[model samples]
Target: MYTFKFIPRENIAQIIPFLQILDVNIPAETLEQRLNEMFDNNYKCVGAYHEDRLIGVSGLWILTKYYIGRHIEPDNVIIHPDYRSRNVGDQMVDWIHAYGKANGCVASELNCYTGNTRGQKFWSSQGYEIKAFHYRKMLDNEL
Candidate 1:
C-alpha cells in the first residue's frame, strides 16, 4: 500500500528526481529557478510514498478564479516508473481530491499534453472531462 501527504515547500527538492519520469530535461539551474518560483507562488505538491520511499508526486494550486469560483489545479503529475501500474496514481489523486474538498475547492482542473495518451486516459478515469483547449503563446521568448 501507498501513503499520501503534502510535501512541505522546504523539502520540495525531494520531488525533483521524480520529475525525470515526466521527461523533464532542462538545465539544473533553470529548473531550480523555476521550482523556487513555483514555491513562491504557493504551489503545493503531494507525494505518494511506500514506507520511506517517495514513489509519486503531483503539484497543486488552490486558486479562486471568476469562472471556477474556487478550484484546485493539478500539474506535473508523475509516478515513478518503477511504481507506475500499481494504483499509485489513483491513490495520489484521491488524496488530492480529499485535500481539495477540505480546502473548499469547488472544482479540479488539469491539462494533459496532447502526446500523453496514457495521462489522458488516467485523468478520464479519475472523472475529469475536457472542457476547453489551453492555448499559449510565447509573449517574450522566441518560438
Candidate 2:
C-alpha cells in the first residue's frame, strides 16, 4: 500500500528524479527553471509514496480557458519503474480529480507524447478522450 501527499513548492527538487524518468533529455537545471515558472502560476503536485519514499508524481494546473471553462491539466505524470503496474498513477489522478472538483474545475486537459502509447492507454483508462492534436513551436529552444 502507498500513501499520497501534496508536495510543496519548497520540496519541488524531490520531483526532479521522476521528471527525468519521464524525459531524460531535459537538464535538471532546465526542469527546475520550468518548475519555478509553473509553481508561480499555482501549479500543484501530488505524489504517491510508499513507506516515505516517493514512488510516483503528477503535476496539476487549475485554470480557466474560454474553450473549456475552468479545468485541471495534468503534466508529465510518471510512475517509478518499480512502482508501475500498481495503482500509483490511479491514486494520484483520483486525488487530483477530487481536488479539481473542489476547486471549481469543470474539465481536465493534458498533452501526452504521441509516441507514448502506454501513457495514452492509461489516460484513456481514466476516461480521458483525445479532443485535438497538441501543437507546439519553439521560440528560443535552449533552456
lDDT of each: 0.86, 0.90
Instruction: Give per-residue lDDT, candidate 2, residue 88.
Output: 86
- Shift in Å, residue 121, candidate 1: 0.5
TM-score of 2: 0.94
Tens digit per residue, CA lDDT, model 1, 10-78: 786787786655665655556567778998998888889999998889999999989888999889899
Separate clash counts for every candidate: 0, 0
Top candidate on TM-score is 2
| Local accuracy of candidate 2 as per-residue lDDT tens digits, 8-100 | 999989999999987789999999999999899888888889999989898988889999999999888999999899888898888888889
Instruction: For each candidate, give its TM-score against the true structure.
Output: 0.92, 0.94
The pairs that clash in candidate 1 are none
Task: In model 2, state the lDDT of residue 109.
Answer: 92
